[model samples]
Target: MRLSGRAALAVGLAGAVLAPVTPAFAAPPPVTADLRADVDRNGRVDITGTGDQTGEDTWSAGRGAVFLPNIDDDAKRCRTTGPDGKPLSDAKLAKCNDAADTTVNGAADAKDLARLRTVPMAQAPKDASGTVRVTGKGAKHARLFIKRAGGWTAVTAKTTLTAAELRAGVELGLEGTDVVRDRAVWDGSAVVELKVTAGSTTTSDKVTLHVAPLLTQHHLQRAQRMLVTEIQGKGPFSRAQQKFVKDLDTQAKKAGVKQSTVKFTKYGDIWAQDFVEPAYAGMTGEDGRPRTIRIMLRSAQPDREAGRELFEKLRGPDMGVVQVTGVKDSEEWTLNSMGNLETIPPYTHGGRSYPAGRIIMGERKDTGSKPAKAMRTLLASQGLQNPLFLDTSWLHVGHVDEFVQFLPAPGTPRGWRIGVADPDAGMKLLRDAKAAGHGKTKMFSVKGFEGMPAPKETIDQTLADKKLRADNALAAKRIKANLEVLKRETGVTDAEIVRVPALFTRGTDEGVAADRMPLLRRIGGSADTPEAVREYGQQRELGKPTGPSVMTSAYVPGAVNGVLLGPDRYLAPRQWGPVIGGKDIFTQAVTAAYRKAGFKVSYIDDYYTYHLGMGEVHCGTNTLRDTTKPWWRP
Candidate 1:
């Protein structure tokens, strides 16, 4: 009976009809259909057999004073169509505003008013949360009301208003973009400003609003299981094996996980694609939704020419290179230098070449054309407009010196000294020992010290006594010259060359060679064992486990967690131990390069295994919208 936000009403005045009451104390007399029909054309169709107060109005008002629906000349032009789609002769559509298009029957008579009443009013849902913050310029002139118990309550009476008042206080122009409600969005639209007022002043607070779901999120728990097997790492799988792997991946897709094919180049062909499948752009995943996978290729050598070439090629159409003229050669050289390289000479170990540098290339996959454009086409290729040289260093081939530059901005000094303390606790022990000076520590007697002052077994001593530096320098010079030939042969620049650092430890055909005690361990088990080799193959099909492993040295920056600059580092897959190990070197270096390029980086080790290598961290995590949730839950 109350006047809600909607513009329709229900009228049943039987009580007033039964008793003759005064006009002020009684309800307004119900108009009769016959009288209404005389004054109005539109009439209520009693299809539901509802009562029609045609001539029941007991009170007869002054004939001249009585008012009727304004059935004007323009209103007469409009008519209501019947079920047969033909206009009714007795009724015509009402014309409230326009003379064309939208037309409703005029409520000239009680029957017409009854017809008007038959036009259903817009009612709120049974349970509706009616208040919503307005967004964008659409908030201007926007008026909404609170709905409670299936009825709209006008919190602001006469809810419609001008743009200024509609904004609630602030001025908002209505010419900008319209507001849209995006359910999947992390942050809602940026329109209404949020502020906290204190006394006469107001301070702007965080204005971004996170869209909360109307329903609870579904969570699932996962279990871990170990798998073991042995098989040759190579080639096109049997149809049966492929089907089996496909089934497993299908299951993984349903479980919201990913599968990857890891191929160790050392075990077979170097040219084998890591993972291959039909384009996923049009593929529907297990959840009956489109599947999206982002492939991030990272290698140890940031300056790997081949890798860079491939990356550039993948970047597609926008393959034009950026050249800064008059830029200092040192800066240019630093920027283009191959990222990861060997720290020591005789770079070859175990009949494999340790890349003097590392380079990695990759692409991010998506179901849309945007990611494809960034990864496959030439649109918005480079994320960082002008990448600054973060740091550079070399190994035994040269001096272990490094240079690092920080972004020039407020509160950040242009440059600062960076140190490389061994994460392996070696540097900590040395510092502790130095702090607790000489006399406090017991020393072994010189008499029992082997070789009195120095051990003859030291590789350093042996190399020095043999004039190894000069011989090694000449050998390195020859290797460099040979590299020049290889470079010419490959047409790859020295800056693109990748080098691998030697591993101090090696793993035997048994377990990790019984002597190595590296704090960090790469996930891939050694290929030396037949069992390990088989397990590696099975893992390729089953997918790698999400786990962490040991890593050699990591670069450290004050503000950045992933990037680092130290004496020297290198990566290689073929060459094992004290030189080059497996492919992780490439992955880690590539991850680091991205960090230096201004992208946030996170490391997840042992995500999966293929052939004899482990999957990278980036391969496991997927980033959605950049809406950040507060870490601390209240």
Candidate 2:
């Protein structure tokens, strides 16, 4: 990968040949004026032709342009505030990677400067002076910086700066002022060119640049640091949650991955992966080092600054944080949350394989619940992972991850296979255990776990509940339909997919539509207190038609929602299952299923912490995987 452009002066640059762009003026202006951007995104600007050639002038997928993201790549301590008296500057949320503030002393930092291309005058007359500007629909939204004196200084469009040395060259860097708000609003396109006039002649070269696409994911996890929220208190999070942290720490350390914990107890949602997308743009520097960015999802879950908070904590070197928000108070709000997001590992279907794999998110079947227009547009624009959707409307939490997971399978032909919830399989496992004379075994039978009361019911009593049976049956039907969708999209055979033993139970309409949803809510009192949620899903409520007739939560914390330590090591939430002879039947079944897929599994007891809270181990912890793979290669 090398950046190629035209019109390099005789500065004795060895590699590329001298190719001057055609001057617009009739008379030769004492020198040929040329502006070279990284038209070919190999990381450096190499002059390849004499004039308007493909790689030098145009931008395309493989080798035509440069890619930079609308990300927050620079910051510092500034005790200032925006309109809302928050803090003046959080260097993290602030995307303006420039020096100083106001309209005065701001200059582009060195790292941010390197992220973009440098449009320099290759070979111009020493006296040759001209004006440079950005043109196109998004021209004004981008800033042009001139490298002079000490550092890079931001210059307005068509700004005439200091004279060129005409010996080496003059460097002018281009930086994106904002992210792609929406495809309809701005499409990330701009052209930086130069018009130098010396005596009578003037010439220019235009190279188009597309704001970088957010690259998708692969199965191989090279964890830099594993993240888990550590909040132990009386309110929402309990001692069980702390125990979950300890368990995850043990697992992470065993896998040779470092683990970090978030001490902030503001938000109740412990799913770190939901707020912070472990994302990377797959763009390399001039030295071939890969750049990664954590694109925080602009989620609207009570606290609006969920984006800002995650950005502040997670942003670091080469890893910037970007938040593309959406229409407030709409389906775009909850649907765009990262809990609903999952990446289908690289697979071939109908002879076509996605190199970056495909991004899969949940959407409503009856009344569509998709991501924000800006987010959907940005995700689709990535080109590698063509996003596909499934009907997660039936889920009370409404996330694809609850039922589906893509695990790395080295023994398989595709190198990965689907690990999905099988309600029927779960029911069968229960029946089988019962048939083996374990029908009277009591469940939720762990000794000293804190939080919700362990349901003191036998397997016989659980199977006898009409409501529970109906709910799991509904879940089974829905899971089958979802599986069909997955099978059609990615050419995975039934044999290749592993069926996890998982069950579901319906929750009330009141719980689903609450301000702070997805809680480990269990109403006290009544014969079957926890199971007695006033179920409502069929009808349209408050003009937002929730199409699914039955919406349900995991009766047994869906084992499919487990986290991966690596391709071969898996961490699953412990099923506080009924003991038969010596082991929990549910735990044994879950372990067996994963082992069949070539994964060594260890169970983390998330019963009181995440299971009761409508989540599991994967929800409580997030991994920043090694996504430095070739964006264009499978």
Q: Which ten residues in a row have the lowest lDDT in candidate 2?
A: 531-540
How much lDDT does candidate 1 score?
0.21
lDDT of 2 by residue, 1-634 (tens): 2233444443246556654455554443256555666554556655446332355555555555544553543444322356687753434355443322312123323434433322344555556676677787757566667767766666665467334543345666665555555556676677777676665677666677766566545556566567766654543334556677877888878877765644434444455556556666645555665544445444433234444556455544444555554445544444666777788877777877776778898887767667666667777765557689898878876788889998887767788888889889888888888888888888556654334444677888878878778988988888889989988888788888999998888766554423113232342222222221112111112343355656777877678888888767888888877887788888999999998888899888876556665667776667777766656556
N/CA/C clash count, model 2: 7
Every model's Cα RMSD, please?
A: 26.7, 8.8
**Cα error, candidate 1, residue 218 (Å):** 26
List the candidates' TM-scores in order: 0.20, 0.82
Residue 503 of model 2 has an lDDT of 80
* Model 1 per-residue lDDT tens digits across residues 55-162: 222212111101111122223332345579964331122121111222322321111111111111122122211112335532431222332333333224323322
Kindly report which residue stretches of model 1 are placed more than 4 angstroms away from their true locations once superposed: 1-207, 210-258, 262-391, 394-462, 465-634
Any idea what lDDT model 2 has?
0.63
Q: Highest TM-score among the candidates is held by which one?
A: 2
